[model samples]
Target: MGDRLLEHEELLRELAAVQDWPLPKRMKWAKRRRKEQFRHWKRWIETDEAQSKCARPRKNSNPPDLKFASEIVLLEASARNDVDEVIAFLDEGVDPNLTNIDGLTALHQCCIDNCVDLATVLLEHGANVNARDIEMWTPLHAASRCGHLVLVRLLLEHGADLVAVNSDGQMPYEIAETSAVLLELQEAMEKNGFDDGAIEDARNSGPLQMLSDVKELCDRGEPLSLADAHGVTLLHIAASNGYTQVVECLLTNEAAIDPRDRDGWTPLHGAACWGQYEVIELLAEYGADLDAVTGTDETPTMLASDQNITLLLHDLKTRQLERSARNKSRPRSRTFSSSSRGHSVKRDSVNKKSHFSKRDIAEEGKQFKADADSTTGDVDDVVIGSLDDENGGNASESEQSVFSTDSAEKKALRRSKSPPILIKTSDPIQEETEGENNGSMAQRDNVVQAALAPSTLEGQDSKAELVSKETPPLRRRHRSENTSGKCCTIL
Candidate 1:
């Protein structure tokens, strides 16, 4: 065998026969069978039938380590005022609105550094001019405070709200360091179509001094919704000063009643804080939101010092509850629901009223039948004829059948049903579909909710609770020793 291996063709044959030597010696027959099968498979694979099933491999797949770096690159370029670099990154699909660790967008940083060209580039690339930082400070605020007149003009021209306040309750104009920047902001605001005269009148003087001028402007078809540098609207000022007619005039011009100032103070909140009972009543009458909470989560009643003002708010709340209860008791005939967008007309009450007698409905049905006959090719007769010809010839019978079905539907609609009050229970109880002669357990749940409604007085400590005569009070310093005047004085 060694002598035969010396020849290349002889060595190949010998190697192929002994290729299965790793197999068990007892399974030598099985190895011979496998070798024969392998030879057949190799021959088949070379044919077209086997070649058609194989697919060509793909190339240049995305690798796992490719990280996103365009935002950081764009931010660095913008900060350094490298216009070309910034442009290159932007062209390569960097987001202009991408914010940094401090929530400062490219536009904000450019304005801070007074980079007018960079700001223009970022704005043209679709950066938000009014984008607020983490502190809620807009680019306009930064530009004005930094005394960049040109950048301030650019921001105002792009429709930035000058009255927008930061988290610290400071507007752009309020933080402006120089008169030149403030004057430019005012001019830009006016040129951008603000009510400059009304705004100046509202900001420069009290409501008593400026009411006539504001009314004249309102007469000239000028809007009264302009806000001052402190984000206080003309209506807010009027409400704060207890100027009832001014408030009414502003409302007559369709001014918003619940516009909030920088500190989340609405007109009602200002009225309550100043103990303006008349303004509070007027605002409540105009449907101002009574449950609105301030930035500190204080309600109007919680901020009022005068007990009368607090009592007025409570009375208004009680009246509102009574009105809602009355409206729920009656069957509404028609309701016109007015909203900010538009008013909607709903006629559910016409079908709900049960006062119409059977005789009246019969007469109305006869009148409807007469009208249907007057019109050519009555729809019901045509449909009945197509369905069953024998029933179609009797038009009166068909009309009567239709009228009777409609009367049945109307009667069903006339049956009024009240919604059930759902009550959660710690222990599951059997559902009671009918009410008892007196109060049910569900009524107790509603009473509990009513008692829990918040209406705390101003300067009252929330941590203290009412104590019974048997319970001991916490130790405290003597009232005479407390010069802070914060001690409670019981009547």
Candidate 2:
């Protein structure tokens, strides 16, 4: 046996060095290693039960009584998920890890059926979480590949190996039926301190034996999406088989919503060709491409075949095209707001400030000034000032702050009460409002000033501003009206 093993190692090494291993030799090596590991595990369990727990401890080759283990009744009860019956059997010393003819433990059956209660009980009763079936599939592999989230978590909590590879040489993560299960497995792997590269090596057996295609579109290009022989992904299979529950589960987990097959057929195309009506609507809701063309230059609608389904696809495509067209054609009016200086105020776009057009401001200022010049003091001032009084007396309060006193108290009060105002004056800020206007002249000046306020802000020029505090979105008002600084602080 030793000489045969040595000879086998040399032959395997030679084949590996030449990169020409045949499938039979590969399977042989894998089987040999597995059997040896199984024997090692059994010996370790028998010798080291006090030291550590065995994951899949083998039974004695010649047992005093084979009655306790290898019973099919426990497995049958587990398959039924009859918690009471399983509990009764476990109390009678029926091993929780008993294997049926297929070498599946009762725990494996519980996982396959997603029997949460039974699984929890089995784990509590010292069932081996990493127990493998004949195919080398642990309970974790069964739960994960079945897309059972709760079962997967239950298995993980019980110390199920996240990176365990089954007979197909795929890890639990590789064959996760749902995106959510895949994420859970990945997170567990990460928590166990497995880096991405380490995990990949475990899955693919290190970097040099890259079975994936090396056809890079460019050195930094995105990986080209690949599929199996027929380019069929799990989603394509579920859709074509009219598996509504599976399709819904995949979509809800955000599987690739519009992956194309080798024939350039999307899952939608498969659903259409197979006359899966609910699937078509579901895919549309999830934003599948309705107009996606196949390699043969046929759309899903063209292949729908059924008249009602064809009309449904047609309507969905029309709506999708309309939405896209509207998006492309609709002007982004809210993007570039009109700036008072007529230059694009791109910076202030985020502030959402309403600005007046330079031309419009100039026109309104001229008209208001003309009106003030024609009528003496207080006429429009009385009308506009009353309208500006907002909240019934805000304008009057501002008036008192501006004209009541020129003392420091008044200055402090104004500063505390209002936002800083922008005033066009070379004089000191205190002096700008120092002297009082006599009668109607004062009222007329106030109205004219509000109307003809500077349309341009000059950095070099000296100015005093009584800007109001910014608040909510400004209500749109005609530039010809409501020129009061206090009235439109938010803008």
Candidate 3:
């Protein structure tokens, strides 16, 4: 046997690698490695240490009595507050960590049922407070979600993980159903040394609670126009989803009515595209710009899905244009009124001064000289006194007349405020005549002329006009053509 085993050592190694060997091949190898066949080769092949080193533990081979007949039954009994059945199973040596098919332990059931006494009994018998179910939901997550504040507090005291996230990326505190549950979780977190951010997280606990937290933060001096990573504001989210109350709350806090996201989509654009009728009307009432174009040149009216919204935006645009026209017309009346008032003041001053003649002016001057000599003042002082009127009231009138040059000043002021008018004409014969006379060509699409203010010169409005000679318009390439040397259409 020793000689045979020594000779077949390499064959045995090969046999071990072949998992699907024939039964005869397996039996032959098994017979050689048996204790009875290895008397002299015991130290090398048949020792207990060598056998143990090469042994593979059997898979799922537990004794039938050791496995529980019903783990879910035990959990159900524990959840229903049947303390007797729970104690009977624990005393019968049932595994405390035995979970149902969904991986939920008995303590998780107790949490969902809000059975505090059952939770205490299971915890005493070594139930895990942080044991996760199929969705990675801890027992505390179940309790928090169902607004079981007392069970949440009890689980926290038993050392549950505070920040464990479930399958939905939500913490137990984040999905807490009621404010009471959220507050209880927050207090527990605070006692465990968490700071103010924990309380803030509790305030923003659930999906619907996020909106209320936004308003509270605004009241606490946070900016209502705060934007997220995507540059989406709270109003954009609320308006897009038709949260009319949240939208009104945000607008009442003075949020920007037309804040645009990174995609150049305003809140009005979002509401319009989603057909949020009330939100669209609220945004329009707060003065959202209807004509504000997006990055793709699409206006709110163009993006709107509802015909009513489109018509409303159209009316807003028309009203805005009319208002701008009225504003432009108002400046002309203001200019004319200012000019007439200046002329009236000048005429009044001229009539009052015309009453004194040149002879009266010389006689008054001699009388003032005699009074100056009688006072015995300096010669320079007497000369300065002679320059002043006796009553001193005419000095201010003279100063006003010196500075009021209305016609030239008003013309220059108006010219500086107004932009130049752009003109275009299509008459080829007139263009040729003007080009030949002025030594320049006229642009076909746009012609910008610089004109100075009008002045009274030989019964004509005299103004110096400077002409910036036109350059040849660049030819555009087809959409598919290369723009290597030509100007590309800039977005």
Candidate 4:
């Protein structure tokens, strides 16, 4: 079996030397050749004496030398998390600091795998904690980039440098997923009297670039309020995009509610012109100026659409009107003349059957009778004096004062009974005599009447029926139509 194994190894070496052949054909030939060689070796091993001799080692042959014992064992253990095998190899004498082709030590692998226990063991075995990979990534860097908080803490506790830059110029703490971990590391460094200017430098970036950076910072529970190149803050972006959740997050963080961009437009103005009702509503709730006019003298209300936005504008206007009306209605102290305080007459007793009571009827009657009785008394006196002088004075006085009180009362009643005067001209009125002259007024009246008519009683009932027919029926079957599947019945 030993002779057969030697022959196979020799055959493989010969195949390796045949590089002049076509690549594909050579590969095919090599495969077949190896298969034949393996079959011969198997036949030799099946023989009883050959198997026994192959199992035993020759007296003159020594064991193969193990190279870089500690380093290789650590690498294997780091890969597999096998502490016992690693310790044995270290005891067999190997340099702990030996690096692979990439200059990455066992500690780097443990960090990459987030294996804190194995990493601790490597450190205890005198492994270089600060050794960097070809990419200049230390075990600490690997741990941070992978979001391994425990490994990060362990490395920092063991004096890992927080400010070491990798190929991408990111620090260990800067790459950490948890802001708490990064902050704790920074505090520890500060407490230990290490300069923190490096950490501050690592966090610096341009505004637009910071959008992505700020997002990461926010994910790490860090505080950020970065603005872009155009002087637009995160709130502006959120409002422009109509990202309600993002907007809410920014607002919750107390971001400026009315930040203006380079264009001098506030978030409310942007939301208004863009037709974002929800965003506009949110901004309004946050006390944004709905009446704020732009450089063009266009208010947010003017930029809004005619649908529900009108309702919002109407509410704003109504509130303003109410405020103005209240101011106008405020009473002022004033003085009046005696003539303004005319004669006061006592009212008669009220009668239940009368819609306006007896006092009102008496007032009406007094107004209608007026000065008619006064003239009658004068005429009576003239006639009486010519015939006889005895009853002349009394009759003349009675006739002269006949309706003196009633005349003034009648004029007052006429003014009181007049219909209420229309105070506003918002609604148009049609002059019966100008039917041909004012076509617009007639059309307006017709439109108003049509609008005032009840929709259910309008002539469009047949059209409504047609529309109902065009509409699709509800997909969900009613229980009344299929009683067999009904869960309940009213009867």
The residue pairs in collision within model 1 are: none
Which parts of model 3 are misplaced by more than 4 Å? 1-211, 327-352, 355-491
- Per-residue CA lDDT of model 2 for 105-189, tens digit only, reads 8888877788899899999999999998856789998898789999999888888887776644568989899999999988888
Cα lDDT computed for each candidate against the true fold: 0.66, 0.65, 0.65, 0.60
Cα error, candidate 1, residue 229 (Å)? 33
Number of backbone-clashing residue pairs for each candidate, in the order shown: 0, 11, 0, 7
Clashes of 4: 7
Give residue 33's error in model 3 in angstroms: 72
- All candidates: TM-score: 0.29, 0.28, 0.28, 0.28
When 3 and 4 are scored with lDDT, the better candidate is: 3
lDDT of 1: 0.66
- Candidate 3 — which pairs collide? none
Q: What RMSD does model 3 have?
A: 30.0
